[model samples]
Target: MNLFGYEIRRKSNNTASNLPASTLSYIGVPPVFQGSTETVGTIDTRGKAGQAKAYALCSPLMSVISKKCAAIKNLRLAATTEDGEDLERPDAVRTMSHPNGVQGIADFVAHIEAMTQIFGKAYIVRMESVGLPEAFELFVVPNLCVTENAAISPALSFMPDADIVDYTVTICGSSMKIAKEDMFIVRDASYDLNACGGNISRMVSLQKPVNTFVASYEAVHELMINRGMLAIISLTSGSGDIIRDARLPETESEKNNIQQAFRKYGIRADQFKYAITSMNAAVSPVSSTITDLGLTDVQKACKKEIADIYQVPSVLLDVEGSTYANAKEAKTILYNDAIIPEANNIFSVLNRIYGFEDFKVMPYYDHLELFQESKREQAAGMTNLVNALNNAVSGGLMTTEQAKTELLKYIV
Candidate 1:
């Protein structure tokens, strides 16, 4: 498949109808730097997406954040008037409840959110039938490249809606272009201009921590395979001089015997084995240990940094030092700070695309038990304040207007 004049090969064994071939192929090198030549740095969109996907698959912390944020299933589109009053759900809003025939609203939005988090952007295609205006389908494009129209002038280049012409979507080694009006894009904040303000993937900034995490695991694996070698053994004669190379082994069988002895009788094993040398040689041990490398501390620090970059609470990643109270609070923070904002951003763009003037579709979380508990607590506090104000007015401690003024402060 060709993307921005670059060719990407498809894997030969990828026969699954549901999977995109581009996803299975090696990451393509971007044609050139997207933004201005004077820009300080360049971003490779495909390469970055590939790296992010690998990290998300390898690192537990990153995987947790991506899954936790995308696991939100309580989202619903609600219609409301300009005066903040609830209105009856319109047909457009009802259609969004199950955007496509296969996936419900929750699953559809979850897929979009997951892709956006991993690839820094997601493209949703609007499949409208010829005569059925209300019967439209929505599905995410697995791999896409945005192409700008040549007709757009330099003055209006920053306006993506007008500047973008079509999206080149690659699927199963085939490619097609979708018109701009039929696509909805959700992306993180971007500073790039040449690529229609495409976002820089968050994984680009987390390379160091992810590499450290992987390296630490590799070191442990190597140590286990080597049978935990802790010291370098040296042989010396009884004269306190190193044994000469000529005196060591003269035949292949002798060399193999020495190697076998060392392998069998090295370090602390299930049963202690002794090496018997007939030359009256003395052995010295040069000590080394994995603890001296401090890999555990390094691994912990890397996990913490990865979680911080994704705005995930560290308590969720590592429950060793977490209490029940703090764990609950951390979950609440994750939902309020990361998940809800992202859901709103996607749905708000959908509302604008449908051009609903009488009502707007939005996601609400009042049904969640976490927020429900908070509401009950708030209601109790408000009731106590109202009773206190009433008692003050009845006891002549304060005038009715003064009590009302104080009550307003709390309500607001």
Candidate 2:
């Protein structure tokens, strides 16, 4: 049964269990649980499903949440860890071995290790959907006032006002997909979508740097008057935590308090515009690495486009020709060294935003260089390493029993 539009029973068992206004939506991590633990891990991607199965386990709370959510359908609940585990078990978190990349193995292990450290035995629901669909997608009537030009209206009346190419860019999110426009205020050169999609084009388009412009404070609020922007936000180098801490209440009165707080923190609307501009320009620094990509340049005009992209900042870029005396000096410019300065500033605003860490860059580069120094070493050690893994699993570093069970997932 599709079972769409059916609301699950709430804890209070109210006849109409609409989600609480405070219901935290999932964004990799559910909002209700606030603390996060960041760790380095090795995911076991040798077998395809190994990675997927384990990543969810790393931040195990969601699994618990999913399990509790499944209780409505009477589905069997059977999920655990290296040791006998349960939603209430304290030692639920365990560290996974470290290696890098999104391979079924390395990525999987990293997540497992993260969950072990951060969410060790925290309150969480569990789910079992070996057979049935886990979550339901329902179509409900729109929530809104009957407005004019319902269809043509921009997805969001007030885009989370942001900076694109230095010129204030409105980031309007919409349930209805709309064509995106970009501007290059730096070179006064804007380009529209090339109508192609690939990692190659994602990188090739940015052969030349696009200069982004910054907008004025007055322009930010004035643009909101008519533009159908989705969210009104201040995107900036400032941390996410700082932005989320806004005391703006749901009512207009709250806005005054929020304004005071904004002013107190020097987060005037112009500064908010500055943040978006920083984010737009930030893409170039991210792209300087071997693999970099981002939004199209302006010329196309209009401020509405949406995208989520990542880069492999030229890891250890410019490290050459430096006189290094020791490993400490070498590490000072490694992936962590190269990316963290800018990255930490990006997430410091928020509690712990993912995708800012070093490992997130591994997926875009040549994998073997990750552990070894040269291509020759990678070629020389690959077979032996794979054999070593198999032997170790057969031996006891992990276990033949474990590999036998997990590796079965990748067998075609």
Candidate 3:
């Protein structure tokens, strides 16, 4: 099958028996290894979208970041003048409220944010009617049925410097080509020059922390499954030789007796307790306590690193010592540093696609509590400034023009 301009062949059950000599030579399979049952792993050449999606699904920290970034759903689209005054929503912009008939704008933005966070790029096909876009369809990333081709005609390119000509999207065995002009792409930074500098996925750069988180999660899972065992019990003779025959209970009666003894003398519900084993068994700790292992510490560190990469605050992920003040501050930082910037980036591309001549489409966040708090603070500050300016002018300490200039400084 052709994937990202490469043909990948699947190994059949018969292997060498079904293949011709020329085909085997072309694949560079050695004669001795051709029929061998050893299976070789194949690398995914398209990108790390699959791996990133898997990480986002399995890793709790990654999932938190994904959900936090999905706050883009809170943003409302509006048409705004150059001076930042809100204008009436345009007919074309209103279509975004229900991008497709199946989902509302909240769900649409959530999916877009999640995809952009995981895959570093998102494709939205503009379904048009009479040279105007009526709806948009979001394509799933890392889809095997999707293929992006380079522009065939220089004059017909979507963007002057963009190389992508069109996207071939196949769904449910049906395929269609979406031209560049009809597709809106939101992408992250890329360092490569090929294929319009293929987007650099955030998850690709977070492999280290994500792996650390996975390893820690697995370790905790195993510990839980083993009932938090910290030591290994072994039957040994006085001379330090292991008594293999006595290591395990021989009968059901013996097993019950051992369990009874442990319950009676071993660590129990009592706060202070000791184990008095009648048998000559040695207790050697094969693993340390969770504290000694620093499992929580390592996992917390990994979580913080992952959150930082996604521009999410650790406090928002329920980190310890999260005060009300700090949590509110973190929310402000989240909107300012992450969510709003991401929305701006996405809508910047959308504005161009919608091609509105009078006003541009932008994200409105004034309804958000964080922004509301900002407005309240501004109002309080402005009131105090006006009162002070009036007092100064009435007291003859400053002229009216000077006071007006001071007020302008504050307002502007």
Q: Specify the highest-TM-score model's number.
A: 3
Each model's TM-score? Answer: 0.72, 0.17, 0.74
lDDT values for all models: 0.66, 0.26, 0.65
Superposing every Cα of model 3 onto the true structure, what RMSD results? 8.1
Q: Residue 176 deviation, candidate 1, in Å?
A: 1.3
> Model 3, 360-388: lDDT tens per residue?
87887779887887899999999999999
Which stretches of candidate 1 lie above 4 Å from their native place? 1-46, 82-84, 90-93, 144-156, 161-163, 190-198, 226-289, 398-409
lDDT of 1 by residue, 138-248 (tens): 887653344434444545555655555566765554657788788888885433444656675666676666656665555554454443345445545456555452256
Residue 326 of model 2, lDDT score? 46
Pairs of residues clashing in candidate 3: none
* lDDT of the structure predicted as candidate 2: 0.26
Candidate 3 TM-score over all chains jointly: 0.74
